[model samples]
Target: MIEQLQAFTDSLPPAVQWIVVIGLGVIPFVESYSGSVIGVLAGLPFFVAVPAAILGNVASMLFAVFAAHRLRGVVRGDRSEAELSPRRAKLKQRFERFGVAGVALLGPLALPSQITSAATVSFGASRNAVILWQTVSIIVWGAGCGALAALGASAVT
Candidate 1:
């Protein structure tokens, strides 16, 4: 699948290939890291690829965070908290232990930024706080992974 995507991306006119990278970055599992790698491997300049990927991933994640925030507000009105399942209890424990910053920073290791950002908001965290931390996390992860991919790609060429 990745090979096919890369081939497809390579087929586009070079002037607009970064646009496809931005679109790929918006996908959940693909996100900025994979998107940047794809863009670079598809022969985009590193500068163009990484930033485009980060922009798309951040935009999508922001949407998820805002939607989750709105949904939480609507669903939480005047209701007592329901009992959590054992799975949810464990997740809650982790959330409490890690807090927003830790989760935002480390979440990409386990899940996509969209899921992490939304979960943080659903936990009643401040929306601005989640956005701030998630942005930081996205930038760091995207840049780090993109750099590594660039290095590896150069080594092979």
Candidate 2:
């Protein structure tokens, strides 16, 4: 799947390639980290690829956070209470222990920024804080992965 995406990205005109990279970055599972890797592997300049990926991912995550914040407001007004599933129970436990920053930074290992940001917002974390931390995480992960992929591509060439 990644290889196919890389081929597609590589086929684009150089002037607009970063746009496709940004689009890739907006996907859920294929967020900034994978987008950066794809962009770098597809021969985009590192400066263009990493920042584009981060921008797209952050945009998507911001949408999720805001939507979740609004949803949480509506849900909070309701009287219903439901038990957490086992998986959700575990996630809640981690969130309780780690707080927003830790979860934002490490959540990418288990879930994309969109899901994680939404979840964090649903759990009643401050929306602005989630945005700040998630942005930091996106940039760090995107730049780091892009750098590694660039190094590997250079080595192979």
Candidate 3:
């Protein structure tokens, strides 16, 4: 399976490679699955892949941050129904009560990356804060995954 995936990614053009990286970064499931695997499949050094995945993930976080900023008014409409649901409302309130650090640490574990981005924005978090925290989370998680992958690659070889 790994070899087949490697062959597939290897056949793609450089532009497609970047697209794949970006796409994988944006999609939560793909982000989780590809975070480590894509780098290994690309035959990149662990250092290269780790940073690339972190950068790609950060790129996606940037997109979410900007989108949340732009869509803030739309998401938080005049009516309560137009806004996030009651459950999301409760979660946002919790984050608001606890402050940025709680959201920064627990958000990734509890929600999809994009949802967490949106939640932070909706909860009136500063754009810079969201970007900073999300970047940190992405780097930490991506590095951990990359290290595991590199270890596995070494073991297999």
Candidate 4:
């Protein structure tokens, strides 16, 4: 799967490689970190890969957050308490224990920011707060992964 992802990324023109990374970054599991790493491994420069991945992840998360926020009331309206899954319950605990910043920052390690952001919003967190922290998380993760790729590339050369 990783080889396939790298191959697909490499098949793109260098001038628009970032676009491919952006599309990958928007996926839940792929996110900015993996997408940026794939971009770099596919021969994209750190400057192009990192920012594009972060932008894509952030854009998708923002959209999800806004949508969830808009529909929070309606979704929660008739839902029974018994419908909550163990995963949902865990996320709720994380929100209560860590608040928006902790959950947003650490969310990528456990789940996609898109999922976490939606869960956060559904749990009644402020939309503005989730966006702000999630942006920080995306940037940090993208940069970290990009740096790792640079180091790996250098080692190979």
Tell me each candidate's TM-score. Answer: 0.86, 0.85, 0.74, 0.82
| Model 2, runs deviating above 4 Å | 1-11, 78-91
**Whole-model lDDT values for every prediction:** 0.87, 0.89, 0.69, 0.88
Candidate 1 C-alpha RMSD relative to the actual structure: 3.0
1-157: candidate 3 lDDT, tens digit per residue: 8777767777877566655565666677445336656776665566656666666667777888899888987856665644677887787778879676567656666676667876687777898988888777777776777777878877876
TM-score quality measure for candidate 3 = 0.74
Who wins the lDDT comparison?
2
Worst 10 residues of 2 by lDDT: 76-85
Give the 10-residue window scoring lowest on summed lDDT in candidate 1. 76-85
Structure candidate 1, residue pairs in collision:
none
- The Cα error of candidate 2 at residue 84, in Å, is 8.6
Off by over 4 Å in 1: 1-11, 80-90
The candidate 4 region of ten consecutive residues with least summed lDDT is 1-10
Off by over 4 Å in 3: 7-19, 74-89
lDDT: worst 10-residue window of model 3 = 28-37
lDDT of 2 by residue, 8-121 (tens): 767878768878889999999999999999888877889989999998999999999999999989877864436556786787777889999999999999999999999998
Which pairs of residues have clashing backbones in candidate 2? Answer: none
Q: What shift in Å separates residue 154 of candidate 1 from its native position after superposition?
A: 1.1
Please tell me which predicted candidate would have the highest TM-score against the true structure: 1
What is candidate 1's lDDT per residue for 62-135, written digit by digit as tens? 99999999998898776654656688668878898999999999999999999999998987789999999999
